[model samples]
Target: MTTLLNVTLTPDQRDLLEVIAAPWLARGEWPLWANVQHHFDMRGEDADAIFHSLPRVGTQTPFGAGYGFTLPMRAPVDGKDRVRLTVAASLVVPKVRPVGEQFVQALQHMIHLYTSRPMHFDQVPTIILRSEELEEALPDLPVWFFDVLPDLLSNEPTIITGGVHTSRRAWEREVTRSVLQYRRVQSVEGYIEKTCEIVVAAAAQYGPAIAVAATVAAEPERSPYIDAGLLAELETAAATNRWKVHKLIALCQGLNDAYIAENPYACAAMIRSILDHIPPVFGHTDFKHVAAQHVFSMKRNDKTHAQRLAAFKDIADDVMHRPIGHTTPRISMDDLPEPIRLNAILNEVVIVMPKSAPPTT
Candidate 1:
């Protein structure tokens, strides 16, 4: 009397899984079986199917895809975040004589093939989403923003014409909106410097034109938050329009997209940095078992920040034109009806920025 969990796969995911199952699914062997509940369209029984069909697209990249509508995945691990005890226990259902790390490695490899990449395991980690905390993460940010972050991580096609610059900047803004609200590193100076480095390196590596535009916009320094030297490097990289991700990754090698994905704004980065700096153990998040791979792709602010600003503004403007749904929009900090609006107004949209104390002298 064991309960089986049924998981659904998208057409693409199903096709991908078929490729991985090939090894185990050789001739003369019994068909591979999955733990699917014996029922037709029972609500929770189709959890796997529903998760795959989510409106937002998911990436099958070696590095795990973040953002987009993700189904909650939980498992009990040894440290801070553990896969669920029950789910982890399910792996033994097949009753292998020696079910251990080797078995686990096999399963992971199978997953990698299905994903179509030899992504570094260290880089790609299974992230569990916290339904409650994620709600808070969306605070003034729109939910749709999450769906687009994965797109930014992918390499754009070679055929698109020159306007990739405009689109690339737009993507940066959307990415910024999604992560700027999350936790990040403590120092803003260290953050922007690293971002510009990544963008420039991306450009020099023959990244798309939009990618180059993102690097160009991030190429110079005006505000104190950025590093001038990194800006110079980006400018030099710009001349050739070629970048190397590995080389540039060294700049802000450690920053998380949630922590350093956007321009350095004392106000925006305030709460996010606090979150990024905290050890995950003490932090409040739905992802109990998170791997060490943190950070997202991002851009830095410079004097040319004007174009960067407008790109993001256009995105925000576009969002304004869409239909509002069951949930009230987030962009309107003021729409926060009396109770919520009261505090926002009092603080002047500064969620974490503290007001300066008068006359400290």
Candidate 2:
């Protein structure tokens, strides 16, 4: 029988589904009620209610006492959210029958393979038979059965397997090899745990100051003094060794904020601080050494840019050490170092720094 189902969800529910469904959607697999329960942190009955509320397609295996259901899920594609259908099959077994741990592990392994790569097809076929006997005794079922089976399957019983289209066979083979050999963080939970540890460590190290600066830096407005792309490169380089560059990133953020606010004195001081902070990245003890000795090969005007930056140090010193007098001193936006000079130094830093190496298996 054919059926059409439509589900309407609240904005919050849709957002939650977007997160819970991402990995399953990426693999073109429908999440079972148990998967939904884990992600949503809901009780079994509630998860079942929600799962059944969504649209589904149902079928039974021709050769075995197996039945399955497929669900339609939403995911973002080409910058727009779209709904796609996914298939999954399971056997009907007596409640007294105990599923083996080996079977459970094989299913998990297959899922890990599917999720570790980018989406290859709009739908992946899946079949979960009852036992090895059932899989071995299987006959050639109708074409529709192949249409509903998964691409990557564990061969060892309880056997899971699927047929792939000719176009996808090559990709499937490569994916299988790479995923089996190089995959790290075996499960989704392990990956999440590692990510949380990194975040917590960063929070403890940078404290609230860097966090606040990051928030300010994320604003849409471009800073007149700092090139955002160059700053991002510096941030990436620093991320490899955060203790060395946390202050530098914060200084850049403060400088950008000061320039946007037209606080010329603050801008001068921050620029001076940044010049003082980044010399070590270039293997120099001080900014003066960086300015005088560091070779700039990208452009002919780089020496002149370095000279201008060196001059700004003196200007900033005047702003910082000039004693308060009966007559107040004046500093204007024009007095700040030219952006080109600072950008030249930043570009050199990005070019000189070693990038973080890719993680190894």
Candidate 3:
């Protein structure tokens, strides 16, 4: 998997990915099992159950089928069936911090698992995971962090609203003191000796190119790699770690201490891997023709009736717009806090930037 993504996902992405993968796994279609069976020469059903366990499969919409995920083989894909396919879609946001990191793990895992199981999700079927629950599902964090804290990806592109709007970041000196400081530090003091060694050695022993990369990542002017080309180059550099370079690249782009302290090797490695596999996914659109029926209702106003069309907006605002930082009992931001934040913050700083073209002829 690291060979493919090079660590494009941060922590929150891993969380979302776990939830995203739950649906298919619950249905006994986990490609991960197939992958395991292929390597270990295990029984089909036995391998299936282990890989499809509750902790793994139940991560999907557990209560019932058809929670929030969009599937291609079901309604939207096939028009011949009356009963919808027994596939459920769901993702539980963690109540703890480290938001985006979860999604990154899940994303990388799911994609890698997909290569093993081609029939379940279809060869890149029309699938869209709903991120709305995440908006209201965050833990009960204060509004202060909310203001400066970067918002995760919304319906829009990789644009984060309601923050100082930085292109790149470095571990702020303060994060070492804050709760986020414990990032990947195996030692209690919150130190990432291996991470610093790699970066310093890469800069000092390797060549001037890495030195320039190290310096540029911490630059005040959003680093010189604000352009797309340089970001790709950075990802290539980080991919050398293969385990966590994406996390490192994110850390470099964002200097949050918690993020840095944790998984310095993995982060740096992921960057290099993703760089090697730049422009990873190309989304193709799919159209569904099922559920031919249309929904119609009467419109009313003045808060007197339940069918008030005008009240739809108000009701939605009250219900749908839950505050961020809330917890998810089973899964959430804190499961791997630092990695998640690193993924989110660094994604903003590194992955989505528009690169400047090299000097043209």
lDDT of 3 by residue, 294-334 (tens): 11111111111112222233332333344556774232212
Candidate 3 has what TM-score?
0.16
Least accurate stretch of 10 residues (summed lDDT) in model 1? 75-84
Query: lDDT per prediction?
Result: 0.25, 0.46, 0.26
List TM-score per model, in order: 0.16, 0.37, 0.16
Per-residue CA lDDT of model 2 for 171-274, tens digit only, reads: 12222332232135444233223323333343445332111111112322223467666677777875665335667778888998998788999999999998
Q: Which lDDT tens digits does candidate 1 get at residues 262-342?
A: 332322323223223222221223111111222211111111221222234333344435575698644432211111111
Q: Residue 335's C-alpha lDDT in candidate 1?
A: 18
Name the lDDT value of residue 326 in candidate 2.
97
* Backbone clashes under 3 angstroms, per model: 28, 4, 69
Over 4 Å off, model 1: 1-22, 25-327, 330-361
* Residue 281 in model 3: lDDT: 17
Candidate with best lDDT: 2
Q: Clash number for model 3? A: 69
